[model samples]
Structures are given as C-alpha cells and as structure tokens.
Target chain A: MLSPAYLAVAAALLLALGPALPAFAGRPIIAGKPAPSEAAATARWLTAQNTWGFLSTISSDLSGAPFGNVVSYSDGVPGESHGIPYFYLTTLDPTARDALEDQRTSFTLSEFPLGTCGKIDPENPTCAKLTLTGKLKLVDLQSSEADLAKSALFTKHPEMKDWPKNHHFQILKLEIENIFLIDWFGGPKPISPTEYLEYGKNQALLKLS
Target chain B: MLSPAYLAVAAALLLALGPALPAFAGRPIIAGKPAPSEAAATARWLTAQNTWGFLSTISSDLSGAPFGNVVSYSDGVPGESHGIPYFYLTTLDPTARDALEDQRTSFTLSEFPLGTCGKIDPENPTCAKLTLTGKLKLVDLQSSEADLAKSALFTKHPEMKDWPKNHHFQILKLEIENIFLIDWFGGPKPISPTEYLEYGKNQALLKLS
Candidate 1:
C-alpha cells in the first residue's frame, strides 16, 4: 500500500488539477460509471449511485397540477441494487400526500451531482439524466419487501432509520412503468422497465461490464 | 493576497480535511446562503444559485400522469436575478411538449447539489429544498422579454447559444404562483409568489442581509 504522505500528495495533485480533469474526488464515476451507450446499465447505475432524486406527483391540493419535491431514495443497499427505487416519506409532506390522492408520479436523477459530467453543462445531452414514471405505492409495512426496503434505505441514508416516530415515515416504491434517459445526443433513450430491472442479472453473463 | 504556494497549501489542507468541513470548494453557500428563517430570501437564493432543477408537468402521452425531467434554467444573468426561472426547451422533448398541452408545472431544487448541505440528509428539512408551482408559458420569440431571457440564459449557459437551430429551441418562463420552501424543520415555509419576488428589492434596507 502507498504511504499516507504519498496518498496525501496524490490527493493534493488531484485537487490542484481537479477542474482540468474529466473526473475527480467524491464523484461516482471514479468508482465506475457505465458508458453512455449502455442505456439499461447506465440507468440502473444512476439509480444505484444516487441517494436522492426529485419526486413529482399530481397535486391534490393544487387542483391536479404537477408538484415536484426533493426526496431521498434507495434502489438497494450499496452494490446489491435491484433497479426499483424505494422512498421513506411521511404524509406530512405534500409528495407523500399527493401520491395517496394520485398515485401517478415520476422521479428524476441527474449525473451532474455525481461530478462525472466534467465541464459539460447540466442541460447538455451528453450529461446523463434519467426520469422514471410510474405509480408510487406504499409497501405493506409488515411485508418482506418493506423489510428489504428499510434495510436498503437505512444503509444509504442512516439518519432515516431514526426519523421521528411521530412523523410516521412509511416506505414507498416506484412501480416503474416507463424510463426516460438522456446520456447521449440522439435523444431520450427508450428503456422499458423490464430491461432496466433485468440489467443487473444479465450483466454477469453479458459483456456490459 | 496570498501567494500561489500558500493558496495551494490552503486548498490542499481543505481537501485533506474536507470530510470534517461544513462547507468546501465549488459550493454556492461559500458566497452567501441566506439564513433559514428568511424564507423568501432562501427561496430566491436557491432559484438564483442553482443552474438546473427538476421540472414536472402533466404528461400528454402518459394520460395525465405527472412527468419530471431534469432541466437547466437561469433565473437571471448571474447576480441580476429577477426571481423568475427561464428555460431553453425544444418541442422534441417531452417536458416542453407536456407544457404546451398543460401549463401547470412545478420546478424543484435542492441544496444537496450546491454542496452546502454538508452531512445533512437531503430529506432533512434543514438542508433547504424549494418547489415552485407555476404555469409554464412559452415566451414569444418576438417579445422583448425573450431577448432579455436569452441574454440571461446565454450568460450562464454559453452552450445554449450554440444549441442546434434545427431543434427550434424556445424560451419558456415559469409564472410562479405558489412557493413551497423548506429551509428548516417545522414544515414548508409559507411564502407567496409576491413575497418571494419582493425579497431582493427589500433586502437593501432590511436586516435580512
């Protein structure tokens, strides 16, 4: 292993040249961001890496207008992602209440936060962005899925496990019906829910890695 | 002013102790993030500082379900923010098309990307998140407002000026009607559109600064 002094020097060099480099510190891409062409893998990877996304729902209070809210979520615990995003929320929040009144929802994530986009503008087509549209349904608290979801969520957002009991936080997951991803210039890549969900299983056998 | 060597050392020290620091490089808060109690200022600051946010609108193709898309927006040319977000969108994208069919939309921004949230969970109310619900109206290319918007957008997003002409990108502005800002624990701050828009003008004399 390299000495601590050497590691510090290397890290200092990275900081000095961070802006000039394509990828740098605390960025998800350094671990491994899939190529833009791998639509399903890229989409899955985004879900797995991002701890939070913007959740949108049809507003009941605003007379059916769409409302977008920043929310924390987990696809799975660390590396064992299953593609479906689980959220811990309370009805005191409009997003959760809106979902109860209207299940239709969409969750959006961006690669910009991951710091992999380099100098590219967040709006640039080359900077990956994903939107998953579906029904936001509450998982039965007593079910096995809820147990798995809680573990997935707590691992990514540790504070979530200790959220105030008075708020009555519940587990909700996006039953993804459609996926909209833009990682390249062509346009939004068409990724079916099944294709995205199955990417991890096929990755071991396929050359996507 | 510090010498180059001293500045490099400072930056290296920051990187070395980054995890322990509440705020670091490239974060918007380093300049000025308003106190959480100043709801209107906090909301406007978020709109002005953030280059992009999640835009949600009623989907035309999805039978009225909500759809959220990652978009880049400019509230103004750098520090001259007018408190209204302007977006350069193409009809080819679903967000623009959806807005055409239904103007009701909400744009969400989070402090997480600004790096000011530090170790706070994004879902925590202290991290500061804003949702602006409004009507997404296409600004007529012939209007003088469109010219100002173009200047504002191009100033921040230089790439937008060079976007493909064939795409027929248009300027869209959000006519914010409701503002939901969660800057600290309690619940969403009650700030009307007028209160938010008026904050900058009143900040000159108010102690909020």
Candidate 2:
C-alpha cells in the first residue's frame, strides 16, 4: 500500500531510466562512469558526456601548420549513442575549409569540461583524454545516414538547427582510423576503431550506463 | 567606527583587487571579463582565464597527420598574464615528441568551460574561442624564464610539481606568430601578436577588468 506520491515518483524514474523509450534532444543518462581499467568503455563514456571538442587539421592557410579549433559535436541523441561523433560545421570556418582541402584531422575531447575530473589537472593521465584521429568526411545531406547524423547532432546541439542557412552549415564526422586515449599513467591505450565504434552493441556497456 | 568583521572583509577585497601584489598559482581575479569588441583585450582575457587547452601538432608518428592533445598550461601567475602560454610536458607523449620534430603547433582555448556562456551553445560566436598558432619551443630549465613559467604553472596546477621525477617533464612555451579570436559574429577578429601581448601593459584593459 504505497502512497500516491511515492507511486508517481517511481513511475517518473522508470520512464527516465527505461532504455526502450526513444531518447530525443537531451543528455543521455549515464548510470556511472566506467572504471579507468575499461579502456573502450571509458573512451565511449567520454564521447557521450562531452558536447564540444577541439578539432585539429592541417592548415591550408598556414603552410601546412597544424590548426586547432574549438567546435561543438555530438555522438548521439541521448540513450542511443553510436560512438561516432558528428559535427555541424560551416566552410566559412577554417576547420571545415581545411578538411575540404586535406581530410586528415583529429578531434580531441577532455574530461575536464564535463566537471568529472574532480580537481585533477586535465593533463594528468587519470583525468582521461581521447583523441580520435582519422579523416573528416562530409555527410551527404540527402542520404538517410545524414538524416540520422543530423538528428544525433541537432538533439545534442539544438541551436544548430536555427543557424543561418547562408553559412551552408554541413554535417561532418570523423572516420576514426586510430584511437589515442590516455586514461591512466602507463601510456596511451591502443583501441581499434572497431573496438570503439562497436562498444555498446554487445550490451556489455549498457549495464554500466 | 567600522566593525572588525567588516574591516577584515574590506581588507581582503583590497588585497584581491590590488594589481601590485605578485599573484601566485591560483585563479586570477579578473574583476570582470573584457567586452567582446576589444579583440586584443578579449584574446588576453581568454588566455588569462583558461588553465588548460587543446594543443595541435604535426604528428611525426602518424604520417604528418595533425594531432591534438589535451594539456594543462599557464600564461602567468593568476592575475599577471604575459599572453604567452607555458606547458609542462614529457616527451613520452606524442605532443611533446611531435613538437621536437616539427615546431609548428597551435594551442586552442574556449570560453565555454569558464561557465560564462550561460545557456548559449559552446559553438556560438558570442561564447568566444581563441587559437594561438606558432612554434612550440622547449624551455631551458636553467633559464630564469623557466623559473617564472614553472611558478605560473605549479601554482595553477600544484599537482604538476609532485609528478613522477622519472617522467622527465619539461617546460615548453608557444612562441605565438598568429592569433585567431572569435568573440562575436561576422568571423575572426584580426589581432597582431604584439597587440595581444601588450594588452595589459598599456593599462587600457586594467580599468575594464
């Protein structure tokens, strides 16, 4: 014989935690961050938690110097994370422009901005940093994959939807070829693209989240 | 007569606001951030406030692909920013190793992490983003400049001082040649390195802060 208030609270909790519900434009519910020992889990967790990252590309404007720019990104819309980060970029900016000229790029994310580092210095290995290196490829706006990627990105970054159309903001993603993750002291963890992209598919990570 | 409690409060406020005091490793007392219209002032302000950034360098190990790494940095002791970023890095990391091979590098900082952007998106031009492109040079430990840089770093990141001795962490600084600042709409503001470094020196920015 539970009180009505308690019953209502339980119902809300169930809806929030239920995985079957179609999660939309909101942050995903990560039950708790995975242990540092779980490299793939940690990498996926970092990507899921952060909304923006520093993107590096070979500069066409600066005689091949490495250029880093801060930009917003999303891996998925809430509970349905695909682990492939999608970005809304405009060619007016050098990041998108550089990618057009030379696709070689790296997207770096840090745990510090997530406020989970807990006073640990960002450079500390334990603080966790993930750099996904590969090619930055543009997504065809007419494709269904583009529709999914745009949904994933816009849900995480709602303002992107209202950006001026003249800027020709396009969808782009990192085709991760090499993963460089430093979550602990020994050195960078070697995580293959398959291990990272297919992380949650086996259901091993669902429980942790 | 003023109460002792009130007097103590006043004295503490004065000490915090005093520009003459030698600020050590702690968050700077920026009375307030400069207006976005002030390009040099805004660039210096962003640099002074952030303690860490994403560093991009040409990867010698990854076939000259651009690599970005999260690293802690300091421009000066709290309130006294010199507009040049200093880093404590070990060659064990690809960033430092890459810097040795190719001096070209870019250090990027975002105002979003400072929590001043409010409900605005991180990619919003009003939120501010800065990139300093130049050569990453290792500092001579014996040089007096290293002593100052280390003090600036250790105070902001005290954990760096106790880092394992075997790692051989060395001090490095970015010799800035180009400045890219986006604090408002319409695109990046042009700011010369000299104007950025001399921002506070002329005392034009002190009043704003």
DockQ comparisons of all candidates to the true complex: 0.33, 0.32
Candidate with top lDDT is 2
Q: What is model 1's C-alpha RMSD?
A: 10.7
Compared with the true structure, all predictions reach lDDT values of 0.82, 0.83
lDDT of 2 by residue, A116-153 (tens): 77777888776889999999999999999899998988
lDDT of candidate 1? 0.82
Angstrom error of the Cα, residue B102, model 2: value is: 0.2
Minimal lDDT window, size 10, model 1 chain A: A22-31
Deviation from native of the Cα of residue B124 in model 2, angstroms: 0.9
Model 2 Cα shift for residue B57 (angstroms): 0.3
Query: What is residue A161's positional error in candidate 2, in angstroms?
Result: 0.6
In model 2, the runs with Cα more than 4 Å from the true position are A1-31, A204-209, B1-31, B204-209
lDDT of 1 at B202: 44
